[model samples]
Target: MTVRVRLFAGAAEAIGQDEVTLADVTTLGDLVARLVADFGSGVAPVLDRCSFLVDGVRAADAETRVTGTVDVLPPFAGG
Candidate 1:
């Protein structure tokens, strides 16, 4: 399964992209682990300050399954 992660604000700056695609993701935790592994410490802090949105809905669980685009929204990035 391909999961799309949309990064905003500092998260996007850390990754240097607005979006990223991950493969074979079963849960949101899986994606986070993969990201930590892939980006090392660079992305950790950014991720910590952000929240996850799964298909436009707020994600409350790290164990939430990835069904569509996962938006990584930083605090007040909408502004």
Candidate 2:
């Protein structure tokens, strides 16, 4: 299924966009891996410190499935 990935603050700046539509991802982990492969260093470092909200609930686990929007938030972001 397709998932919407939203980036905040430094993460968004690094990727040069706030949101991306990704396909063939089932878990947050899968999304991370894809981001790293697609964006490389530009996004990898940001991912290291990023926290996530999947469908509006905090995604504390990497295995959280991406059935809807996944917001990638960094600390002190989006002021």
* Best candidate, lDDT: 2
Query: Clashes per prediction?
Result: 0, 0
- lDDT, candidate 2, 6-78, per-residue tens: 9998889888889999999999999999998888866888888888999999997889888889999987835
Native-vs-model 1 lDDT?
Answer: 0.87
Rate residue 11 of model 1 by lDDT. 85
lDDT of 2 at 51: 88
- Best by the TM-score measure: 2
Across residues 21-48, which tens digit of lDDT does each residue of candidate 1 receive? 9999888889888888887877888888
Local error of candidate 1 at 28, Å?
A: 1.2
